[model samples]
Target: MSQAAGGVGKRIAKGSMWLSAARLVVNLSGMVSTVLLARLLVPADFGLVAIAATLMQIVTSITEMSLSQALIRLDDPTDQDFHSAWTLSMLRGVTIAVVLSASAPLVAHIYGDQRLVPIMIVLGCGAALSGLANPWLAVFQRKLVFWQEFVLSTASKMTNVIVAVAVAWYFQSYWAIVAGIVGMYAATVIASYCILPRLPRFSLASWRTLLSFSVWTSASQLVNALNWRADQLLVGKIATPTVLGYYNVGFNLANLATRETTLPLIQTLFPAFAAIKHDKPRLAAAYIRADRLLVALGVPVGVGFALVAQPMVPLFLNPKWLPAVPIIQAFAVIFGLQGIAGLVTPLGMAMGQVRLLFMRDLQVLCIRLPLMIAGAVIWGVPGLVAARVLTGLYQIAIAMLLAKRLAGVSLMRQLRTHLPTLISCCAMALAVWWVAGTGWRLFAGYDLAQDLVLRVMVGGIVYIGARVILWIVMGRPEGLEREAANMVGKLRRRPA
Candidate 1:
């Protein structure tokens, strides 16, 4: 391997650790928040907050500087690059906050929920803070400072929980929970500046250097952000806030599996994909490997969740959230399929296949938007859940085609690579399902039949051991052992 190649492997190692650590931190934080808010507040409270946050999300996303992306993607970004990015960020942040604050009441009126205005304005502060964050945090990620990212992610979220819970308990209103989001993000912005080795300052000259780099990424990210949140939009319009709240909870849990699994793939595989950007052969191999890993990681995890969806939801989010169980299972399966097509999006993005990436999303939108609308109209909550799963399969089909066309990741390559993981996951799911006697027997308010704990434990351990045996026996996954060893080195480097 060349120095850059070695760097790519090391970076992947670091990204994996950082993302995994971040996932754990975020999940724990998310779990805590979900429990507290669910116990203290009702779906209606979550519903009120969701509408404001969703609109604010649109603002934050559209106004994004993509400074981090600009810095990381540029072949030779400079200090000036960092400075310009930060300047652009701060201006945008301030602008969004002011606009949002002014428009919050109007937004709430349009949504037919006047109470949402204050929450919208409250969350708007985060828009400004995010925009003002030191753009050099990208460099931390670029430099693979995984541990710092890990600590900061955990700490910031823990802060959010502490504040949110304290205020919610004292006031017994949803405002405290809403404000917690804004406060935590502000905290994160400050923490990022402190932790980053070289913080970027405001500079016009630096701004000029980064514009071209920032524009495309910013557009892509903006569109992507909108795309991700569209389901919420559909639900909010067609269903009641209480109904949308269930949808959000369902979506959240689904993401916990897919997002947790592929989160590292995006960061780690990007550098690797960037390296082999010019080589079709290497790119093809890389995509297949990534696809296989995604399947291996996602399939079992998703399947496990689907198996235990009923039990897990009640235990995690309270009985009031039972409506979310079906939706969560639906999305879990969707994400599982998408997981198998993971490389298509990143590989497409990295290889200047922006048009392909956009088109694929467009195709997904084409399939999803209409279906989502129709489903929301017809089935209401259940329709929402089915629409998500159906649309996901539609997108996955398109994703596979794009991977085939762009990266030459063939049908056989995908099948051959995924067969073992798929089989193992299926076998385990069946075992769990069988043991649960089809998840049918109810004990008290919950089903006691699904032995989620035992099923997941035995299945996961067996599947993982099988994968390890295969990886070693076949001498496959070109960099498998090296990556494992690299992970060990990273763990050793962590502070006591």
Candidate 2:
């Protein structure tokens, strides 16, 4: 590797670690908060809030300018660039707040729940506060300096957890979730300014420059949001609040395994890819390496979570949430497999292929919305879950094709890259299933918590063992195994 490539890799690695640590803290706290809220409130409470949240997301997505992304993409963004991004963000936020608040009554009527009116209005205010965050924060991302982001995310999420839990305990209402959402956004805006210490000026001097790049990005965001949330919206409309609540919580739990694992890498990849976009060879190599690592790390967690869902759901969430078990089990593996194409968006963005991304999202939405609607109408939640799995698989193929087109990495080669992780995960899953299925028969009197712990332990051991054996059998190729060894070496060599 060239000195520049090596330097970029180091920065990317460091930034990823920081962001990953932040995600770790955030996910841990989030899980705790979810557990507390689940115990304190009924599924109906979550269902009611999920309806309002989905509408809020749809509104925000439609108006997304992606100014922060544009600012990050710029080689040398000036103060005017930052100011313009901030101004556009503020404008977008205000627009979303107004639209959401205005549509509250209609949304309530559509969902047949008057409670949505207040929840939607409160969430709209949160959206506006989100726009007030410092645009200069993009500078840290541009430079791959993520410690400040770490601080900002951790503080905000911790605040959310504390406030949500307190409110849930005291009020025992769905409003607790709404309060947490608003509190997180408010905390983010406050923390952003404190970390960056920037007094953002309102300006339009560079609006054209920012928006020119962001228009396609905004379209992509809108489509992507719809692609993910359409099912939830349909469920909210067709199903009861209690059922929607079950689906929402289950989907989120499934997401935790995949999103928490791959998202940190995805968050860092855009700036990292952009930094080296001029070097095609290095970029291609980096893309493949990152893709492999994501799959290798994410797949086991996802599949393992699915493997243990039977026991895990009952243990952490209690029997009341057992209805969510199938949802978690089905989606966990699907989301994990999604890591195969997880980096596609960042790759496209870095290659200045936002138009292609928008097109891709549009294509998926066309396929997904119809399937989602049919599934929901025909089979209810189970049908919807099955439809999502099918669509998710289709998306993986689309992402692979896009990756091949942009990076010239063939589909076969990409599949090969994922082969080792796939094999190891399969091994891990089989071992865990055996323990849960057959071994549990051998070991009598095992409670839900014990079964969950045993399965997790067995799965982790099997995955690591299989991975190592595969690496050796494959001649210790340059991939995640090597990367892990190198990181370990560096850590060991450091002063105590």
Candidate 3:
């Protein structure tokens, strides 16, 4: 490898480390807050918020320009680019605020719930605040040095959790959920300017340049959001608010693992890929490695969570949330598959193939919207979630084609990378099942809490044991042995 390639590799490694640390901090706080809120509040509270949140997401996504990505893709960005992007953002924010404010009452009336009116309006303001955040943050991603991004993202998450918990304790209503949502964006906008120390000017000198790049991305974002939020939309529309809340709980819990683990790595890849987009060999290599890495991490967590859902649910959540247990199990596998498939979007974008990305999402949206709605109408929340698994398969197939066309990464190569990880995870699941069944038979008197803790411990040990054996059998592919050996060498050389 050239010195340049080595340097990029080092930067990617460092950036990933920082992002992982940031996700750890954020997810810990989020989990604690979720536990407290779930105990103190009820499903209806969450459902009420989801009603307004769904609308706000649609509006924001429909209008999003993805200016940050455009900026990041540029090899050399200028001050005018920043100013123009900020200008576009300001206009977009105002538009979202106005549109959301206007549509709030209609949405509330449609749902026959007047409470959503104020919540929708408030969420609009939050979206606007998000629009005002510093564009300089993109520079961090562009350079693959995300220390400031870490600080900004972590501070916002911490602030969000703290405020939400305090509010929920006081109000015991959906207002706590609102507070968290708004607080996170406000915190991000404040920290963005402070950390980057940039005063964005209102200008449109680079408008044409940015729009040319972001137009397709904007379409993709809109369709992507529709597909992403289709289930929530369907649930919120057909089911009772309380039912929607239960579904939301399951969805959120399942998604939390993906967001914290697979998402951080995927987010880092866009710029990393862009840096080497012109080099097909290097880009393909990185893509394969990343695919293997995400599968190795995601499969175990998904399968483990699915295995222990029954015990874990009653222990961590209130009994009222027991309805979400099955939903959680279904989505655990879905999210695991999604983590592997979701890589195609950023990779496509980095290769300047946003049009392909947009088309893929559009195809899914056409099929997914009707499918989710029918499922919800026919079988309720569980059906809606099951519908998603089918859609996920469709997406994975499309992603495989995109990988082949854009990166020359064949499906066989992809399967080769994922095969060992998949096999090891299956072994781990079997081990966990055996352990849990044996423990249940022996300790008939154990409560859910004790059972959950024991099962989790046993699952972790089994999974690690299976992974180690597989690693040796697969010749320690994807650099696991090398990374471990390097760490050991560093430990030996340390002064301590």
Candidate 4:
């Protein structure tokens, strides 16, 4: 790499740090607020609000296709680019907001719930303002100024929690929940306005150029919206609205860890990767490096949560939501593989293979929707979750191919990087199951607490010991050879 390119790499690395930390802070806050909100509101309230949000989501997904990734791929966008993009966003904002606000009564009429009209209107306002945000946020990302975007995103999300939770505490109604929604978009607009760069005048050339992608991207958004929210609609239309609430809450909660961790990686690294598409070797290295890092992070977190879902769920949500427990666990396990998909999606677009990526998602949605509907009819919420989990396995194979073909990183190389991670997940699952089977009861007398502590201690020792041994045996822990050798010496000194 040249000195200039090396500087970009270093800066990308630094920016990745800021972006990752911002995601961590924001997601953690959002998770806490979810727990609190679940406690404060009734299932009906959550259900009602969820329906409105899902309806808005179906719409929001349709409209959001134009901005981020398209801008990322453009090499050297001009002021005309900015002017046209900003105009596109503003126009979408007004159109979507009005459509949502107006459709409220119709939605209420369909769902037979008169209360949803105002809620949908509020959500529509949020949708409207969301379209008004930093077209330059994309520019910030394009320039590898991911940290600036990170700061704006994090601060905006925190505002959502503060406004939503405070209002919920006093009002204890769905409107307070709506306030949280309002606060989030309000924060987005305010932060983007303050931090993103000033725009140039609206230019006809730029308008025409961006319009090409804007239209297709919007179409992409619609397809994605339907495919993404298919489960919510199926569950709501077929199952009880309350069941849909439980289903969405559980699904979103389960996905939080993967979504939070991997999203920033995509946002930061896709632009970074796009900038280096001409350099195959550099692109390959970056892809492998990112794949390894993501697998290491995502797999363990997902599996560990899956294993420990019992205590984790009730600890966060009320027991009334116990039904969501198994569903959440299934999702966490499936989503853990999402890190692999994360590497694929951006690598695809970076290499101009996004059409393939879209086609793959299109396929998944086609299979997944019918199965999800069948599952909702038969298995109810868990069936919907099972369909989602099933999608992951098929997608992983496609992700592997994309990794190899697009980035020149072989599928074997990618799997080799994650072999230990796979082992670690299995270890966590086995340890949790063994400990759980031993009936380490903890809700009883003092004995229960003592038994619980013992279970955790033993489970940790066994799980970690197995992973360390496998890591050594597989020759994947060469980087930790010195530490392993020292541990061997210490073990030899013991009374055996």
Best by lDDT: 2
lDDT of 2: 0.89
lDDT of 1 by residue, 226-328 (tens): 6677778777777788888887877877887666766766666765676688989877876776776677677777877777787677776688899988878
Best by TM-score: 2
**Number of backbone-clashing residue pairs for each candidate, in the order shown:** 2, 0, 0, 0
- State TM-scores per candidate: 0.87, 0.96, 0.95, 0.89
Per-residue C-alpha lDDT of model 3 across residues 242-343, encoded as one tens digit per residue: 889888888888777664677778888898888889999988988988887887777777777788888877778778899988888888877886666867
Give the lDDT of residue 295 in candidate 2: 90
**Candidate 3: residue 156 Cα off by (Å):** 0.9
lDDT of each: 0.73, 0.89, 0.84, 0.74
**lDDT, ranked from best to worst:** 2, 3, 4, 1
Q: 325 in model 1: Cα distance from truth in Å? A: 0.9
Q: What is the lDDT of candidate 1?
A: 0.73
lDDT, residue 71, model 2? 90
Higher-scoring candidate on TM-score, 2 or 3: 2
Least accurate 10 contiguous residues by lDDT in model 3? 437-446
Q: Over all chains combined, what TM-score does candidate 3 have? A: 0.95
Backbone clash pairs in model 4 (N, Cα, C under 3 Å; residues 3+ apart or in different chains), count: 0
Q: TM-score ranking from best to worst?
A: 2, 3, 4, 1
lDDT of 3 at 476: 70
Residue 140 error for model 4, in Å?
2.6
Relative to the unseen true structure, what is the C-alpha lDDT of residue 481 in candidate 2, on a scale of 0 to 100? 84
Please state the error at residue 226 of candidate 4 in Å. Answer: 2.7
